[model samples]
Target: MRNETYMWKILAKTEPEKTLYEHTLDVLTVLKEMMKIFPDVPKLINEPNFWDYVFYALFLHDFGKSAKGFQESLRLGKRWGYRHEIISAGFVACLEYESEIKKLIALGIASHHKEIDELKSKYSTHRKNSPGYERYTKALREIEENFGELVEMMKLIPDLSEEFIGKKLTNFKIPNSLDELLDVFSFAVKSYEDSKSSGIDRVVWLKHVFMRGFVLGCDYLASSGNLEIPLLKNEISEIIRFEKFTDVQLKMQSEDMKNKDIILVAPTGYGKTEASLFWVEKNQNDRRTKRVFYILPYTASINDMFKRFVRYFGEDLVGMKHHRAGYFIYQSFRDREYTPDEAKKFANAFVDLSKKIYKQFKIITHFQLLREIFGLPGFEMGISEMAGGIVILDEVHSYDARVIGLLIEALKILKYEFGARISVMSATFPKFLCEVFKRELEIETFITAEEEVLRKISRHKINLINDSILNGVDRIKKFLEDGKRVLVVCNTVKKAQEIYNVLKEFARGESKLIHSRFALIDRERIEKSLKNESVQILVGTQAIEVSLDIDFDVLFTDVAPIDRLVQRFGRVNRRGRLNYADVFIFTGYLDDDLKIYDKELLDRTISELLKVQRINEVDILNLIESVYADGFTQKQSKIFNETRESFLRLRKEIYPMLSNKIADEDLHRLIGSIEIVPSCYENDYLKMRESGNYFEVVKFFMSLAYPQFFKLHRNGQIYQHSHTLFCLAGYDKELGLLVDEFETNILE
Candidate 1:
């Protein structure tokens, strides 16, 4: 059996090592998630040559962890650290190579975590002669001294050797010679010329540093046995069967969402994930040219979706991004060339895995989305990796304006530039979103099965009772009296708190309140609270809207935007139940701020329903679509632009204060400049951010359960309150970031 543990012998206490470990785990976790998206990879590993090099690169990428200064940094956990990575590079320096293969591997390993300079700077030689010539020499020496005697011990498969020797590979150097450069280009980054890039060719794609990365990744995941992989396989079929989608759905409604960009606004509980699967299945093999980017609004939702995919596809096909817990990606193990100093060659495994999926097919959430839309310094390689995939935005309607703007731009790139497809699905979508997609996209379509679709699929009644706050309280009371599990949903956080407090007086024991205010653990505990049969009433804001697999009977919601109202309705009578309870939308009383948002949504809903002048057309989905068709026009384009611009302006307005310790007096000037009066990071919020990309960072914030508020910015940065941004500057928290407690500027 291949050894799974990847422990650097002389390293335990050091800051750099810890950071490296974190980085290693983050990379591996993304790879392991391959199972969630493409579970058949392990089976591919059964091939001897392919598996060996992949494992070799993964295992030794961080061999520099054994150095003393690296140990001291971890022990002290300080800012300044020694160059133990160089010490690890020394292992590769001792190697004896036919030319410089061993040294190239070492240079790849040494430069994994940190940015490397030119060979000329380090070796005092001609940088023009070799891009990574300095470190490559060191790597070659390490192979001879540190791992020379162990050559016999390392797995030496013939096919693997042939594959490597046949291809002349170099590191970080684009040869000046046109012929050599073209050869380099062909070895890497070529598209679709060979979609069947499994086995030997796959290993070649990730041989050096990328291989070292896969082992480190697998090891980190192995350390945390408690890590949970979402089980979406079983849930998908159940979701489809329970909702009873028509046979015609197997062949996606072409006109509704043909070969065009689209945003789907069907009610919640409408078999969306499965619909994606149907699309995938129909286009399978043919659409292997692209993968699927599953974009979710929350980590909890992502987890749920991950599990759904795992259950459906199994471990080999998926890749996960569990941003809240800890960062890790998984890949299979194998053995090969070992040089102590020649580590750090595995940093590109995520990029490599993404390439595999793009060549094959995959299902990922924000991992690729954030990268695809936004550029990263080292991993520009991922852009091509995301080549063969459709970008699916689930719960997009739940996004704020900034997120909406980001999606519009990103989808535009995927659609027009990349020739990729985009499908935005949510139970609720407003007129603004419809206008955003219909007008902005090159070729667009809209598929809203709304209430009519929901009703047709599985019978349910939408009993819109009295529109009053007292009615909301009354509805909860009645549901409890009826001995049914009730789900109460409100629009804003403040309103949710007030109604919950009042309902507490009328309700018995075992009622639960959940919202954006609580920490992630608290929210999870609250979610767990629902599992008990004794729990009767569940009340919250939009936080409990969808992505959760909770079952409830009756639903009471305050007057909300039409799409949100539909989403809340989805929470009830989801799985075929006759005698459905009433769905009351209380619309009378509203605060000034909410009045503008709420009335606009409600006015559109009511106006549309009145046009037909019949109860039959009151189906919320129809009401929502009518609002879009009637309300959206060239005139409405200005609102989309204004909303997007203002959100970005607000982000820029408040971002500066986050980094800077500003004078209190300037706070007013800062706030005044904000177009939307951007909200500040939570007052009391600090938690260890498990390292991951922007999505995980955001999810970790939501997981903090501290009333954490984050905005998925149009720049692909998800800003939230965390100990990480302050220290790492990942979310741009640095000097002069904050004007005061709540003011700063975003450099658009």
Candidate 2:
């Protein structure tokens, strides 16, 4: 017989060798913490004994690791053909749980490490003479001996039976044969998958998936005991307190938004954020809402919103999540006084905890929400968490047709399927898009800025210039010479850079250039500087479109889509204090401008702007409607339909497969953006890596559109260093990433 002490050392490691008992206890503690954070998890599943089932699963998840053969494999660092999850599933099958509960627990245990296909493949074949069979036989015998010991250990915990188990374990039996065990496991897998396919009792399906995700979360926290999972404090005080609401915000508050979905259309700086927050606050008492997800389209906007929300809701209640969330959390840690090592640890812990237990008020990109709808791995937990939450879709107009289609599907699932409350807001929500929503989701609450307020916010004097961007350079210089804060917007990065180069020489005040190609850290720094600087000549691309709150006295922009043009105009005279600000709309195209932007849309935008010498907020909706009256073109409609069809296929067919057929990288590629660290920063990157502050330095990495990255790669202007792409092209500390003049294929 194996000694208990020997069994305890079976899964030993030098870093931290937690005994099986200690690990189990740690997992139990984590489960309790998770329960506290999501107090209504049990209610979400509508299972009174949900916690009991979870406790049993957690206790037995690692039971198979106790097998003597498995222990020897771990000790010798040998490849074990069979995983412990299969053995644990066998043990779970012997439990006295009813058929349905046992099936759920068994499937969860078996799938803890491997998905369904791998599990089936491993167990489907049996070779009695194989080493795998010998190990399996030994593991079974060991489980028989240790089963009673586990029961005895459980009794030692205070009120274990009364509080969790609900009864004392006296009798249990292992499957009489290996075939029987395999058969039982196969049955559970089939039954679970079948139920999921049938869509019978979605609550039951959610419960099973939630249990799997919860168990995995607990197992991870227990194994890597480096972090404490922080629970979100969801008191009413956690709602951001506003001193006063603007006129629009006041209207939002006065309206009855309880238990209703809303679509609010307002101009920039019209208190849209406050209005959404107020609506969430008014419905704060609703039991259906588990948390709040304030979704934005861009990382910059998400970061800005995260900080703005942190001020209203304390830092502890708000979290910023994105591809570079680790970097953000690291920066937050660096903001305080901490040792280098301490900061690294805290940053890692904060990120881990946030992912495990999302904060009450989360500022995240829409991709995160779409991930749940796609039913990827660990998304079950996300779906459950967001099922009854409030989702605020900010800047809904910024996404392309493909993304807009996915967003609409995700909203449908969130609102109609999961009982979530949704509020979609944009500075320029077009009538065509609104009609689509009304047709699809039947959204009734449509709020827009009052005509008077629109008139007040309509502070731009529009001027159409049927000339090249070069012609606008002199106008930009004139604005800068007059001491008027000048903002020049280009349709592409190359144009922006060219225009910035011209304005830099002639500017009387500080000149700055910004675009999507700059590192996130640099872009953020520039944005911060722009906010503080009163008079400056700022040049940028479409990066200036949404959620950036910088205001200027005059604007020079290339004519594009009406909605995009409106977004650019919003940055000028943003406070509505001036009688009117000048906005010069250059109508001629630059290099690849026609390819980048639809020519017909540009023509329509120019035509519409020519009609309105003084453009206001009310003019925006009508202009957008006119531009998008026919909806998506043939190619765009095809892309949108394909994207939506793919989503449905994944959710219905592919997701049910035992294996995850869709890769996250594939999805990211579809998103068509990649983050790269410039070669010039390689030394700093290496130094940061060595100093254990890599996460802090990650913010400086620039994200490039796929076409741009490919162009550089084709010219041998980009290099790969340590999983990051480094561009050999020139980059300026102040001007940001620049396009070399020699490039022939400039992403037309």
Per-candidate alpha-carbon RMSD to the true structure: 13.2, 4.8
Runs in model 2 with CA error above 4 Å?
1-52, 69-82, 96-100, 114-131, 153-208, 220-239, 285-289, 656-658, 690-692, 718-721, 741-748
Report the C-alpha lDDT of model 2 over 314-340, residue by residue, as the tens digit: 766677678888777677676787766
Question: Candidate 2 lDDT (Cα, whole model)?
Answer: 0.72
lDDT (tens digit, per residue) of candidate 1 on 34-113: 33433222233233233333323333455445343444455766532334344444333323332234433444444444
In angstroms, the error of model 2 at 361 is 2.1
Which runs of model 1 end up more than 4 angstroms from their true locations?
1-113, 116-248, 253-267, 286-290, 325-368, 415-419, 428-435, 444-479, 482-484, 592-599, 606-618, 629-748
The candidate maximizing lDDT is 2
- The alpha-carbon deviation from the true structure for residue 420 of candidate 1, after best TM-score superposition, in angstroms, is 3.2
User: What TM-score, computed on C-alpha atoms, does each candidate reach?
Assistant: 0.56, 0.86
Q: Which lDDT values do the candidates have, in the order given?
A: 0.45, 0.72
